[model samples]
Target chain A: MATEEAAGGLAFHPMDQFLVRPLFGGTEIHWYTPTNVTLWMGLTVLAIVFVLVIGSRGRAIVPSRMQSVAELTFGMVHKMLEDITGKDGLKYFPYVMTLFCFIVFANFLGLLPTAFATTSHIAVTAVLAVMVFLGVTILGFVKNGAHFLGLFWVSSAPLALRPVLAVIEIISYFVRPVSHSIRLAGNVMAGHAVIKVFAGFAALAAIAPVSILAITAMYGLEVLVALIQAYVFTILTCVYLKDALHPGH
Target chain B: MATTTQEAAGHAADAANAMLPGTDAHGSAVGMPQLVFETFPNQIFWLLVTLVVIYFVLSRIALPRIGGVLADRAGKISNDIATAEELKLKAKEAEASYLRALADAKAEAGRIIAAARAEIQADLDAATARADAEIAAKTAESEVRINEIRAGALEAVNVVARDTAAEIVAAFGARADAGAIEAAVAARVKG
Candidate 1:
């Protein structure tokens, strides 16, 4: 906030854009109240529908550009799902693909100027991670019953150290959802914040060019990070799903 | 040293206000709203709705269409390859049968050639044998005619010699009888 008033007496509120104000101009945000977050999230869904549903409506064998993009995204995620979880994992392909498409769309949409990054918040990511964690855990129990507990037991370790290892394993296991959620939120937040700080520096004539340059560089990196983060999140989900289906050493 | 001291003072101020809920040097409701926790429920609710809608769209519509195109391509390629393999097998069988027929034809041709040569050889042998028989018969007949001519000439010569002998006796005027002259001429010729 000091940086806001540091240059030319103009207050540059970089974090101000992240504020969740009601779209209807009300001060308070109720459960049913629509906010900028809702607008952007809705836009994200519309964007997905446009590209995936309406774009490939013709379903030409030799696809148009939009259809090609849709099929490419579909095949990429399909192959990733198949590769990580094998054929049986394809049963949950739609759910995993939904998570991937949503996160990626939200991330890329956030990259637009003055756009709100819903994925940058812990609340959004925590829900996704917890859902995956709970789903996999329940699946493990259903598929393997009592053997699902074997994931925590260090059967390969020495008998003396097995208990110690189990405790550590259990702690890490519980930490999975926390780490998963925080990793995505932290990376997205850091990139956007860095860009905002650079943009704030752009108010000064002396450093305006340098700040713009830095913002451009950071934007490029953020673009790559957005895609990579989405991929990482999906693949990790697949790995956890694999463990649930087959919970051995 | 002066800059470091001022930085320390700034850090102290930040630490003091950091504990206060949603208030910092940026004033109330001015910090990162992502940390505010007020907007979370709304964001989470929308995210859920969006994700559920996307899942249905993909599973119900988009995925099945793309899957159909892929399966159709795979089916076409495999069918074409299978047809090619079948044609290749047929071509190999035809070539094999052609080679078999050629070999059979060659053997039949050789048999025909050998049979023709043998027949020609037999005809040549019969012709030579017939010509040899004809020459031998002609030579035997010629030898018999020569012997007959020689006997005829020898008889003529004996009669001439007896007539001349009687004429010479008659010129000497001896007056010899026919039976006595003949007996004398025969005894002289015999001697």
Candidate 2:
């Protein structure tokens, strides 16, 4: 460690990798600024179009490779929506599909070298989670009318415990979005930061081999985490949607 | 590790310094870049735009097109199956008619054989009847001829016996009258 510091110090700037810099040279990050966020988000949108729009453009009876992938993604989300929220939930297909496609593409795209993971940011995931939270709550109220409050009211609990259980249920219900957003961002950020930390150790010749091995392993896990996080986020939305539709239990 | 890396990055940035956005004046991240308040607006705006675009693209164009394709494929498959089934029915009908024609031909052959047999049987019966009638008429004629011959032979024998009786009466020398002898012969013949 002493020798490494004496060797003009190790160049360890892991957090700099996440710096949201302007694509065109300027320091001011306005709301409309064309930053790396815009570039990555735009790429994410293009990736979605490639898969969903162009992939299924053939409309072949026997599907092409891209077409089948498109169909598989569509069917998987559709089935999840049906399983959780039943037939009426299919009306929200476009909304649900949008979230799924955006998250999945952003996540996978972020795995590339020097790519910014838009989904790893709290500002981003929180927006999606809060949207889902508000949408579900509103949908619950609209669908079930006054009966939507039954979600927190535990009718099945013993008379003495009902109020206490209701309070707990209310707390947990409100905590959904917080946990939801943090779970994705935290998972993604933690994996990336870990890999970066390992990258820092690669500066020393003695530790380079082991450090690279650790980075490799973490990278593999991150790949899995990327897809799984997308799936987890979308499925959770479906579950919340189900709750909104059927608030009795 | 965080402080050490931050210090090192700080020094490095200082040497070749230009403070990047989302970093401190020393070019190290203030904390986590994710916590940077300034970039939130940029990320949120872009994300909203992306989501809205994706939603519109999918609902308006992608989804409906994919769904239409699926439905079209299904409908086409069923239509093909129906056509195949109709052809199969037609084939079956053709086979049945073929079998019916085969049976009719066999029935016709049987009818022809029966008619031929009946005609042969009738001709054989006619020939047999004609042969039997000819044999019966020949036998009747032969019997009539035999009866006539017998009658003629019986008259000759009667004439010889009358002549012999006359000669015997003359040889006895007490000659009875020829008319008396003839009367005796006639009485004997009558008795």
Candidate 3:
């Protein structure tokens, strides 16, 4: 509640943007609270339906503008999963597509003025990453049995160093979810926080022009980050699916 | 804001900040709202719901339709290309058949012309032979007629000469027989 800057008349509350307040005017935030998270996530769903379902209602061989966009997203995610995991992985195309559309739509929608980024939350991204991690791990085990653990074992390494290499690989495998989740949340949060900081500086007319320029530049970078982070997340998910489908090396 | 409203801005900041998991009594964020552990449950629950909803929507509806559209486009393009190729083959066949018909017609025309020329030459030869035969016959008849007239004229002249000789002998007071006069005239003529 006490920002040192706020007491010093700086009045910069950048982190305030991410607060989880109830949508129906209440201070309490229960697990089922219809908060801004709900609002934005709902909007993300509507946007997806609008583009993917209603946009392609024409089912035109020559697609409309929105249909083209819908097809582009669908094709990109579909190809990424298929390329990484091959044909057998196509069964999980919808799941991968779900992750991609959720993150991408959430990221883009968050860029709007006064929009709360659901993807920017660690809790949200962590859940998504952990779901992919658990699902792939389970799938690997189911498909390959005990051989799934061989993903950590370096078969090419010398026998003496193989165990150590396995240890390293194991650590890296566990770190995937942490890094994956944090990377998306961190990138989004940093860009937004920096923009907020710049906005705070804009109240001072002397450096308002500089602050505005910085915000504009940061906005451009944030937009790029938003799209790139979604791509990164989807690609990583596909990569993990690859490991699950073929848990050899 | 100026220095006077420093405390007031913090109060305003409190108005925006939900005094939830990571906020102090003054109602500003303790650290990052993203790190607050208490709200994780809400965010996670919502995220799960969203993911499930998206999965059903995509798997059930969107993906199949989009895939169908792509498949349909590909099929249509290939089908159209196949049709075009068939049409091209048909055109080529038609052109080849047309050329063959033209060549056949030309050959037939050439044959008819040759036959007509041969027939015309034969008719001309027959007409020329008939005219030559007719001219040969007419010339032979004219020669015979001329020979007959010469003989008749020669006889008349001889008779007149004999009469003239007899009249001259009588006028000279020396009578002469017609036989003698005739014999003399004949002998002089023979000499």
Candidate 4:
């Protein structure tokens, strides 16, 4: 590709440097590296802080409209936690609710053209997945001690097959993090890539009109996918958290 | 027939692939390395940090506050309702007592009027009996006085008759027999 073409936004690729690049040498820092994650995380944090500050400011006998909204959101999340985990599930509500809000906002932020979809990268998603995996696992062990290991074998299993059953259970348990991470990453990556490809057609002069329409439709679909992915990720985390808190049941 | 369509799609895909040298149909593998970076570690770190923070905030702050507020609200509402109900019951009892008192007052007033009437009737009956007795005594005395006056008038008439008989006998030159005279005087006296 010519320099002129490059300057004119001619792609080596449309999603070329999704990763952050270092400003000084690679040793110092990279701009494109986790560019989306940083921005999203910042935005999410700011939004949460703003909500909390404004929401809690007017602790009145009767809530102001903003407080009411905050209350409504809290109530909704509380009810959801109560529903999923039963009453005992309430102890973990804050963690689950905050996780939900943060992820949802982060995912929504990625929809912007200039923004990075951090979750689209397997590395980022996998890291998040592993944390949940490890945290829940540790919590389980700490809470139930060696009894948590019994999650592998059905207490009612036939005596002869208990060992074999334990192996399968262990394998399945180990695969949990992998499946969880890949599910989120694959969905986000696939949706974004598909949108990018459709968008590429709009660049060509001959197919501009049809390509624009198709890309527009795909963009709309991608937005829905973004929200769904966020919801799926959050709910799955709740499930894992549940398993950890109470291993068998 | 399905195979034919698949083959046609495959042919179209092949043509497209020929047109674009380095593109996956899914467009995911383009410009990406064969050895993908291991995402496990990074995902684990961020998620763990987020979970811990959220857990702490919820357990320590958010949930406690919300729970407290909800409990407070519930307590206030129940208290208010209980107070209202108690007041209503008190009002009902007070109203019932007021009505009962009114009814008793009316009954007492009625009884008082009845008692007063009985007392007035008794006094009137006593007065009437005394007056009747006094009238009877006066009537008896008047009758005795009338009998005395009648007796006096008859005595006077008797005296006059005796003198008149003696005179008339002397005037007629008739010999006045002593036994006859005596008999006539005795008759007058008896009359």
**Per-model B-chain TM-score:** 0.52, 0.52, 0.61, 0.55
lDDT of 3 at A130: 94
Error of 2 at A28 (Å): 0.6
Q: How well is candidate 1 docked (DockQ)?
A: 0.22
Ranking by lDDT: 3, 2, 1, 4
Judged by DockQ, which candidate is best? 2
Error of 4 at B52 (Å): 6.7
Best by lDDT: 3
Q: Which residue runs does candidate 3 get wrong by more than 4 Å?
A: A6-8, B1-18, B133-191
Q: Candidate 4: deviation at residue B50, Å?
A: 6.6
Predicted model with the maximum TM-score: 3
User: Tens digit of lDDT per residue, candidate 4, span B1-191?
Assistant: 34533443454466644211122454323454212232223333444554465456555665566556656777889999999999999999999999999999999999999999999989888888888888888888887777777777666656566566667887898778656765697686787
CA lDDT, every model vs. true structure: 0.81, 0.85, 0.87, 0.64
Better of 1 and 3 by TM-score: 3
RMSD, every candidate, angstroms: 9.0, 6.9, 6.8, 10.5
By summed lDDT, which 10 consecutive residues of candidate 3 chain A come out lowest? A1-10
Judged by lDDT relative to the true structure, which candidate is superior, 1 or 3? 3
DockQ of 4: 0.09
After superposition, the stretches of candidate 1 with alpha carbons farther than 4 Å from their true spots are A2-4, A21-25, A54-68, B1-29, B119-191
Candidate no. 2 TM-score: 0.78
- For residues A33-79, write the lDDT of model 2, one tens digit per residue: 79999999999999999999999988899999999999889889888
Candidate 4 regions exceeding 4 Å error are: A1-18, A21-34, A84-89, A156-165, A194-231, B1-64, B120-191
Listed models, DockQ each: 0.22, 0.39, 0.38, 0.09
lDDT (0-100) at residue B21 of candidate 2?
46
TM-score of candidate 3 to 2 decimals? 0.84
